[model samples]
Target: MSRIGRAGFKKQVMFVLTISSFIGALIIGGAVYFFETHQVKKNAAYLIQNTTRQAAVMLNDRLNLVFTQYNKMTDKTSLWRLVNQTYQEEDSPQKYKDILECYRDMKEIYSANSEIMDSLYFATSDGTSIPLYKDMIFEKRKINLEDMFQKNYEENYGYYWLNKHEDQVFPTRKPRYVVSLIQCFKNTKGEAAGYMVLNFKSSYIEKLLEKAQISENGYMMLLSDDGFLGGTHVEEKYRLSEKTIREILHKENENMEKEGFSIYQVPLEINGWILVSVVPVGDLVSSSRQFLVILGITILIILLIAGIFSLVSASMITRPIEKLTERVIEFQTNQNVSFPVDKNMGYEMRILAEGLSKLKERVEELLRQVKEEQEEKSKLELLIVQEQIKPHFLYNTLSSIKQLISMEENQKAEDMCEALSRFYRLGLSDGRDFITIQEEAEHVENYLLIQRYRYAANFDYSINIADDILKVKLLKLSLQPLVENAIYHGIKKKEEFGTIVISGYEENDFIYLKVFDDGIGMSEEELKELQTAVGRGKVREESNHFGLRNVNHRLKLYFGEEAKLVFESTYGMYTQVTMVLPKTKGEKEC
Candidate 1:
């Protein structure tokens, strides 16, 4: 045999191959371990974040439902009659009759959603606490209804949410913990008539948290500025510590990791409550540990095989290894590159290439999933904004209707109710996003009609659209908010009666819809501030220009950057809001 096939050549090749395989294994295995661990953590955090957000939305919706039910109940003529009746010092037949009627009404409302609610209490200024299921029963723990009203009703003008507490009003029943919504209603003279206390079952919220739980070890919790309200895990040991709660409350960051746990927090819009999701880091990366063990064993096996091959065919092995290294480098530089398996590249090389190919596919799949998730999140946010707008308008309109009924303007109230029905029917548009300009115009007309009844001599309005553009498609509720802003912020504030002109026209492949108000127009400073706010397209909790901001956001979302809201105002003279929409081809009603 030649010197190349002798002991010297074999020893040299074995040492070099052993060293190379060991180093390669460490480098590749470490990179994979880091990547896999990072991906696992990222996915866990994303899931937890979404869970917290969705929980908050669900809780908010439930809370809003309570308010909606409250509005409907309070709007009842019988309930209004009961609140208006003064409590006579002497027990009279009429007093008992009023109580009975009120109890029946409350019972009906409670029965509809009794699974979610514990009891409903309608407390009057005269110190009567009427429960839904039964008559007022005075127990040892007598809840002073007047004292409760005086303590909270005055501070919180409209409504407020209470923490979990024992059901004091219904002490005779089984001991049950509950969360309460306390709202005060006012009379025609703006004086407090009575209060409505709707107690929600705590177990219902706990169930919500349980349903929102992300993983076996991960759990969800409801928190407020004060502390923990409730959670999925009832055990003290399973619950998050006070320190973590405090940190979450004080920190502005929505997501944080502390004490081996990843925490995601979302604030509720209905109340200033917080929804929190907690997941263990160990649980998030538990699979990564198994992957690392398998990887290590595979690396050891590959190293042993390489050592054996080095003694047999060192040149062939080295050439293929160099080609593999070059391919890996190329892939590292450009992730779009594919690692294709070749029949001549040997079984081990082909297996490695296949692994690389699968990794690339997985990465691309994750990217696609992320993109879809982001789109869904945006759509959800838009839906939330739409929901927020609806409730405020409904509450205001219902209040107007209530006032009209109280004044006994039956004819005007009937007209307003009809207008409201039409307004909502068109506004909903069968859940379609785009509506014809004619339908949008009609929706705004109904809204204006309702406002006309509310502010009889305060303002007059006109909607003028070219006949040709009426069939063009536009976003639903696009003009109604602008019309509302013109009324309340502009016309209603002025001393003299003002005029609002809503005009629509098509010009140069774009449509211009304008709401012009001859009322208390904004000052230069105010105009600039309002413009900047809408330009940024972010909703501020304290801002009174939500209508304007919301409309501008929706416009930009659907119509791209070319679509915008143009504001023109001169202080104490006039304000005009023009919505610029890019006309889409083949516009038709849905």
Candidate 2:
């Protein structure tokens, strides 16, 4: 053959070999990419599925813990012991004081579990129930044991629900639900003596779901086996619908009865109580596209170095983008929202990002409106509070006089009436928010005398006004309500003989007035609620007094945030409320 013919043949062979090799590499890369992408999606799906199951298991465990706490708080043995101590036998003054102590201790136990308790009650056989957990109060009422207690026992024996008022003990107007179980107490003869009720709040159980650390975008819910109970902290729309939940009820109910784990593709049935976990599934699988893009870029660079497999690398790049596009579409359809991506994305990615900016604008507008509305409401409420004090003083004064006249102490009572008049008149003395400690102390002393006459030595109070603090600037009426709470709930409720000791002194560039009382000390839960109420300045009408909330509010309003109230209490013994006041010059330490 001629030399030129041979050379031409060699070139044709080389070109054919290179093209074939590039095609082979492309085919291999395509196969690997497809397989890896499938594996990634499967792994992501598996992660989400397993996490859902685990969350379900944890949720069930937490619900069981809530039940266990409810039972513990409502234990018949302890409650009956309390009932017998309080009612069955006549108790000495000291013994009665001890009972209050025990009640306070029980409050601690319930307080520790308040996360799951809406409100707990100690209902006596006589139909009087005192709220021992949360801040619940029920007025004494006539109730039929069989109709209220027995019926509730049958209805709530083995289930949980949004609680209706068990009976007249809880008024119809209150907005609290009781998730409770009852335990029957026996007398010495083993007859049914009385019952102890364990009540949990719906919000408390919701807090349990919240505390489980469910993923921010994912949530697990506890549904009744019968489909009668269900709630979630996640957004409302994400919550499983009744139709969807009822569908899995059979399986859920069956699982609740069974002794082990239950799995079902369908979430509803009569026997199927479910742990339904919903997660943002697309967020979990984006790693595959990231890996594919990285792999394609590396292959393209390697091919460019030798012009081998360049076609294959380009095909690899296009393949991943197409797969990612399909996933974005699937996610959009399932979630009923556009994919959260940028609008300026390349032509292939524009669909996901188009409506995002408009959504952002709408969200911002909504937030702005919400903020303005909140501020306006706060201002209006504050104005109303400032104007409402006049009526409150007039009312408390009239009640005090009515009690004194009913007792027929016409002479000493007149002086008290005069003192009450003087106390309110002090508010007009200075338009300034601040007043002297002496003036504040006098206000409390007048109030205390009126209470002393009403409670008739249920409590004894002592005051020591430090000479230095007497003329120092203090918040008006700051000391009165704390002293009043000590007398009413702490002393009168628990002790026939209660003593409150008040002292004022200087400490660390500040003036402190200490009000310590040997009254019925509060349990941990009451103390927590009291602290929250103080912090938020919220007053509950059922908490037996509106004065403390108002007093604390005024103190914070006047004292520049540093002058405020602090308290400590031990059940059945003593509670101390401290007023922190900034010191003024020329204050003598008394």
Candidate 3:
């Protein structure tokens, strides 16, 4: 009876082990498949999006070059003279001479950029066309200049980009499509003198799209609101219908997936044209499919080996697991309890024990880190308060108020008192670390206003900040310290009166607040030492530059490591101090 009980117990253990191993394998393999597929799609989208944007930039650059040359030609006095002169009147010799001069100038420009230009010409108001290189055999079908001008011209000034159309002015045996840029020139009286036409070959745009291709099956096409302009490496079946083109143009999202293809669109700055890139989804995830297959085969083999090992090792694994459980319970009560590394146990059991031992040490280290962080927080708060209210600044402001009152300037004194009160109120910010940029600007304005009275004609200040960035949130009192530094260290030492300019603007996910002064600046050695100190972000007790270091550290602590202070100066010439911080909208309290 006892022998029979032992055999039944071993069978039960083997059954449980096999079931657990199968479930774990399924969970792990499914997770990996999901993650790998997601990662592949994200990477493909990034590549195609960047590819389309770069292609748009290249096309815009080429078109801008053509526009520049056209502007130069229009600015020429000879071209204007040719357009204003009329051959109907007498003096045929002078009319011919003016035409020849304008044609020669146009020919020079065309020769320089012949690779992109199909033809360059001018159409005058007197119903005459002057071509740089006239066709030897003129086709009977002449392009209607009046109809073309009326249809393409939007305003009476600037250039207009017309849709691609068949070439009619230039004679060719084969059918050729070209995009035209037309500009209406005005005479001295602001009257429409004539229109200048510059034709650009469509093939040049297609070549640019070809260079921006991202994959073997990927292609790019340029589309306007009306229709498609040009495409490169496009298959016949992938040609978009009129309805589909409208849908793509009106879509709210710039990047999307349709059918089995990933599509990315970028708007051209030169003209209102969309550059679209199409890539196959299958191509992007082909490697992921292969990875799934390998993962499945590996999991199956692992389960098979686990099944065989379970029958022999089930009893061995159960004993150590039971022992480890008791130790875990003990650790919960007393974290000092150590997990024993038993040599007699299996390899997995030994590894688990070693891991737990390391975990205990990590927990102790984390506690120490938390304590240090608390101390640092307290120190930062104290520094902020100290920088906000300086004893010398308060004393000088009061003395200025006293002088203004004694001179019977009660109104001026009252204004000074009011500015000081508002300054302190903003500095407190109701105990909040972050405030809107507008509030910070107002605070610094108050500080500078009071200083103007104290320094009198020694310095003057101006604040020029963009309205769009005024509502963005930033650390409270961020600008005051920089302004203080500029006045004390920069402008005070100069011989002549100095000017301090404060400017703020947002660009590319960053906020730049600059304080500039034309005064005695630091030499290279002094500037280098100051930069090093700012980088360390440690406040020196004995130094007069602690305000800068304090602000730098506080910015990093609240915002991130990327927030910093940058300094630029030339000895005895000028100084510029900039506070760079991330552009954030939400108000984060301390």
Candidate 4:
């Protein structure tokens, strides 16, 4: 071709490339925008739906737990028998004393488990009501209870759930929202003696709903056919349209836009409940506009690629300008370019992209590694905290050892000193955290001996270690905590010295190490709170059982979830703490 022909050819190539690039950019931009918008909205819907459903399930579970606890307290057949055995008529002085004792025991049980109960009343067939509260029965309750039970009442009607009563059995207290579960109990022959009515305040349901909600703006509402049983997260002056809530539950999965707000709803069918979450739509979609800039950059990069490809494949004619183009084409073909860059900016961006690509793999690996490393650190921290008091005791034991040496009883002195030395040795054994059950029993024996000497045998201790379980491994300092708590918290406050029994045995797949103290034991309420905290893996700030909790955590960490600490206590009687450990560590080894 001539010079003029080649020049026209170059102009035509540039024109076609410019038009095609513009059209292709528009197409690519539209695709990105559409794809991003669709995915983002879809993800938003999924997140809200999942969150709402979880909130609903949590509501159902929490309510069920509350009711189940109350049911167990009032409906146990054994409890009814005890009640009858306590309240029998025409009894002698000894029998009446037994009745009073049984009544006190029932009062304690009622107080310990009644976190939500407003009143628990026992109405006799003779129209007499015994309301257990403040350690005294309110006699006036029978005035209202006269209507509750008919004379010579027989056969149990099971339980009746009374809603919205607001009836206060006690007249002195302020009135509140009240619901009662009324149940009639019968003797073994199926003759009803009386009724037990359990009353609950609205605050109980409020607490339940509050615990169930997982989101800040989210609220849970208990709906029945009657509408609005109870709920939480209700804002003052903010009207909730029942129709809108029903519509949301029925028709919408994404945003249900109302005036200035959008609602998402999930229904829990178990208890006729609905969980509603509301957010301003602007808040949901405001950040999503960032995708527009990303789409624009993506189209610009695509256009650059197409333009470079066309330039590389253009004619190989030898004009002055064509020679320059031929050189550009040759460079493009011979070298591997990171991007279709005509200038310095794209080349700089390509370097940045490569750096990010290199970091991406390391960042992902670090994320997975960090969680496990952090967990290990937490376990070590627990160990360090539990081992805090060792040095002071060691110093004291050494002082005692010196005193024993001065007494001219070299055998006794040597034995005490050896025990002291071995205590620390077993504690810091090769810097390991676990030891055999036999070693743990020895450690506690040493502690008891030291204590026995210090207090002049003010408290006696008995250690019974089963030979079969002696080979089982446990965390260091596990047994000492329970013994120390028994001594200081139980025996220390008692008028007379008490006996502490440390016993260990293997049962099925687990090892049970129990510390029992026959001293001024904890109340039923104290036991209940402690057991609740242990079950939830929460330690109370005011609790004196830090060592026990620490040991409990380590056991759970090393011995699977089957490992835990259990407590049983009776006021003015005794307290027993059992540390349950799995026989093997399973996947988590020492």
Error of 3 at 4 (Å): 27
| Clash pairs, model 3 backbone | none
> Which candidate gets the maximum TM-score versus the true structure?
3
- Give the poorly placed runs of model 3, Cα more than 4 Å off: 1-337, 540-542, 584-590
Query: C-alpha displacement of 580 in model 2, angstroms?
Result: 86
Q: Which ranges of candidate 2 are over 4 A from the true structure?
A: 1-34, 49-78, 81-105, 133-195, 204-217, 225-237, 252-274, 280-590
- Give one digit per residue, the lDDT tens place, for model 2 in 172-269: 45655555545555456654545655665556545544554433454545555433332444566455556555555544332221111122222322
The clash numbers for all candidates, in the given order, read: 0, 27, 0, 0
Model 1 segments more than 4 A misplaced: 1-25, 76-97, 133-140, 150-156, 172-174, 185-193, 232-238, 287-590
Which rank order by lDDT, best down to worst? 3, 1, 4, 2
lDDT of each residue in 484-514, candidate 3, tens digit only: 8888888988867999999998888888899
- Residue 181 accuracy (lDDT) in model 1: 84
- For candidate 3, report its TM-score: 0.47
Better of 2 and 4 by lDDT: 4
TM-score of 1: 0.43
Candidate 1 global CA lDDT score: 0.77
